[model samples]
Target: MLGNQKVVQAFAHEADAQEKFEDINEDLRVWSLKATFFSSITNPATRFVNSLVYASVGIAGAFAAVKGLLSVGQLSSFLSYANQYTKPFNEISGVITELQNALASAARVFELIDEEPEVPEKPDAAVLSNAKGEVSLEHVYFSYNPETALIEDMNLKVRQGQRVAIVGPTGCGKSTVINLLMRFYDVDSGSIQVDGTDVRHMTRQSLRTSYGMVLQETWLKSGTIRENIAYGRPDAAEEEIILAAKEAHAHGFIRRMPEGYDTIISEDGGNLSQGQKQLLCIARVMLCLPPMLILDEATSSIDTRTEIKIQKAFGKMMEGRTSFIVAHRLSTIKEADVILVMRDGHIIEQGTHDSLISQNGFYAQLYNSQFAV
Candidate 1:
């Protein structure tokens, strides 16, 4: 609500939002009513039963006393015993509702625990070390659903220290390429290799650590600026963190904050602007200086001026490091060592920007469409 309040109000969705809120409120109201009704009945029923028992004991005891069949002290002791026995039922009734809620929550938790993992690590997986950043996908086939074909017979090779840019329309497998390279999803019928070794044979941790990533959407946890910058390398020294922040052009803003690098950010960086969050994420990846990099529209959120600055910083960062850049903005990737244009999950055009544009094919058409007056 806080993040999107302006948007909601601008679109005149106040009524819709209120209606949804009331719907949730009504459901909760019904739930509370049911709980309250059950609780009220159980507690009062226990009390009523206890009271009736006490009344019966009193009346019978009085009759007995009148008939000289019971002592006053014995009658009082019997009444006290009956009260003690029924008191536990009242306590138990009070907690029955809470117990039911807890049991239902536990059942949901156990169901989540029992579900299978989508990507499981192997026990005997080899550790990828000192990678030269060579990557290749061989005759790859993958689909989210078994019956649907997303990517098929895909083949590509990326050499060490090369910058490969992927450009395509939405749902054309741009991000999926990054997922395959990162081993987030294994190819259905082929192999992805890094440094001549199949990725599946490498330990997931070691393979993932070899690459630094920055995405269009930024994610920052609740922490100080310094902590967020050092997320990828928690043990990074103060100097190292500051240097990376400087490289990413985030150090100036950090120092300007009320507490400098110590300024506490709210959850998901609610306290900071989108560009600031993106800069911090970029700083994190810069600090790691991984052998390979994956940048998925890394500068999309920044203004043009800031984007230019970040692109310069990214150019420096990508030096001698294999980088896979997935971007919708064609102009940002002109300097890429190789460009792969995808459509329908296939690499339809592959060349340098100038070479592909000269061919005057799909890549040329897309590029021209963007720059068309």
Candidate 2:
């Protein structure tokens, strides 16, 4: 909530957020009070019991001493034993809050551990070795909820090394096409295939390894710059890593850092700007040099000049390799070999950019809408 304060303010939901925060704060306050009451109760009660025991022992010991029935040393020894007996209870009470927190965290961990994998790979699944990058989806049907349909009867085919661009309005299932191809979600019916072999028949690891993906939302682990770039192929040489960064136009900023490639990145690259993080993610893909590429608005965070440079780099990287580009900006996909314009989970039109624009259809209108006078 603190991180996205600007978003809350921008949407004019300050009061709504404040209400939520106050509710959470109230719950926390109640929990803390209960915990403090319980924890605080144990120690004082034990202390009072100890004091009473000491007082009784002292009085009895003094009486006994006066009658020469007990010695001073004997009373002192009994008092020491009492103190030792009560020490552990005090220690345990002090740690009650910590123990509660640990148990709560453990419960959450166990819950995650018990979750079943949605797309489990078969034990005898074939390895997709040296994929030729010929992909096809036939009569695909899928929906997150069974009652509501998303992608219905979708069909697509691409030969080796073809650049296919998917363009559509918001929520038109452009990203769903990428998800199906990647097998992130299994289709309800029909099969998605690569090189004439169904993806379900292949090992998920082998199938995913065939494509290098870069999403609009970049992900980077807490590691040095070099480690993130070489995440896919950890054995990548330093020179190869540098070359990839250079190609992605990330080297300049990376070199300017305090420790260059050795500088540690905060969790999820929090220390870096969004554009810089995207560039690093692109460099990671470049280093991997997979047989296929899936770019979903990969350059959206980048400036126009930087995007142009990255596009040229992408052009080189995509040479003779099958690539799927999911983009919102029509201008960026003008050079695509085939553009698939989707609407409501169906491909309404598929053709080259010039051909689609010449038709003056939905794609043309979308393109013109961006630059309308």
Candidate 3:
């Protein structure tokens, strides 16, 4: 919960972390005190109940002896026999109470076990093998909620090694198409095929491993530059790692660091600037060189000069690989073999950059809006 304070602070939420922390601390205190109180009483409570049982039996035996219905020696023997039974009864009660607490903890474990997965794998699914990177989405449909439909009847196709750009305003289902293609969420009514096989039929590892992705929001682990770049292919050679970083224009900055590529990044690359982190991410993907690529506004964080260099690296990376580019920056994908314009959960326009500009449609409006005086 203390970790949550960072997020609250980061977003400048009105909620008071200290106030919440005090309340939670009070709850913890109460819980701990209650547990300690229960534990402290267990043995004493058992002894108190044992004494009551013994006293009642002893009193009854003494009265019987006085009436000449029982001998003094017999009373002693009866009290001894009673202790054997009552002692176990007291111990068993304490054990039962302790087990109840343990069972409560076990129930939490079972809750995790009982949770249903969002995507269940098919029985006897085949591993996707020898992919040529021909991707197609045939009549796909999806919605996060029934009332707020996102993508409806979306169809797309990309021949092997082609670079296709998806352009649209936010919430126009461009990322949804990528999600469906990756099987992050299955389409409601249609199929996403990779290399002539439906994504559902292949192992998620197989399908995802075939694609190399670099997103606008870069994610990096706490590791050295070399380790982060070789994350995808951990066995990648040192020379190959350097080559990838050089290609992505990352090597120069990395070399200037105190330990060069050996410098360890702090959590989420906090030690680095946003553009530097993005360059590392691009280098990481470049090292892997998967047959298919997804660049989702991948250069948005970089300055114009860095973006130009990274774009050149991307040009090399996309060669002979089927690539999908999702960009709000029209210039980044101006040379794409196909440009798809999305609006209101549908593909409204499709063509080359020049062809789409010539048509003077939604794509033209979006492109022109970026440059409007």
Candidate with the greatest lDDT versus the true structure: 2
Listed in order, each prediction's TM-score against the native is 0.80, 0.76, 0.91
Worst 10 residues of 3 by lDDT: 12-21
lDDT for every model?
0.91, 0.92, 0.89
Number of colliding residue pairs in each model: 0, 0, 0
Predicted model with the maximum TM-score = 3
- Is candidate 1 or 2 superior in lDDT? 2
Worst 10 residues of 1 by lDDT: 116-125
Give each prediction's root-mean-square deviation over alpha carbons.
4.4, 6.5, 2.4
lDDT of 2 by residue, 1-373 (tens): 7899889989999999999999999999999898888877876787787788878988888899889998889888987897888788777767777888899999999999999967777888999988989999999999889988999998889999999999999899988889888988889999999999999999988989999999998999998999999999999999999999999999999999999999999876978999999999999999998999999999999999999999999999999899999888778888889999999999999999999999999999999999899
lDDT of 3 by residue, 1-373 (tens): 4556668878776367668778899999999998878876887888898899899999998999999999999999999998988888778766865787789989998999899866767887778766799999899889977888889888888999999999998988888788777778888888889888899988998889988888888999988889999999999999999999999999999999999999999877978999899899999999999899998888888898988878888998899999999988898899899999999899999999999999999999999999899
Clashing residue pairs, backbone N/CA/C < 3 A, model 2: none
Query: How does model 2 fare in lDDT?
Result: 0.92
Tens-digit lDDT track of model 1 for 1-373: 5579989999999999989989999999999998789867887888888899899999999899888899998899999998999899889887887888899999999999999876666778889987899999999999888988999999999999999999989999889888888988889999999999999889988999999999888988898888889988999999999999998888888999999999999877988888888899999999999999999988887788878888898999899999999887788899999999999999999999999999999999999999999
Q: List candidate 1 stretches off by more than 4 Å.
A: 1-4, 39-103
Give the Å shift of residue 334 in candidate 2.
1.7
Deviation in Å, model 1, residue 91 alpha carbon:
10
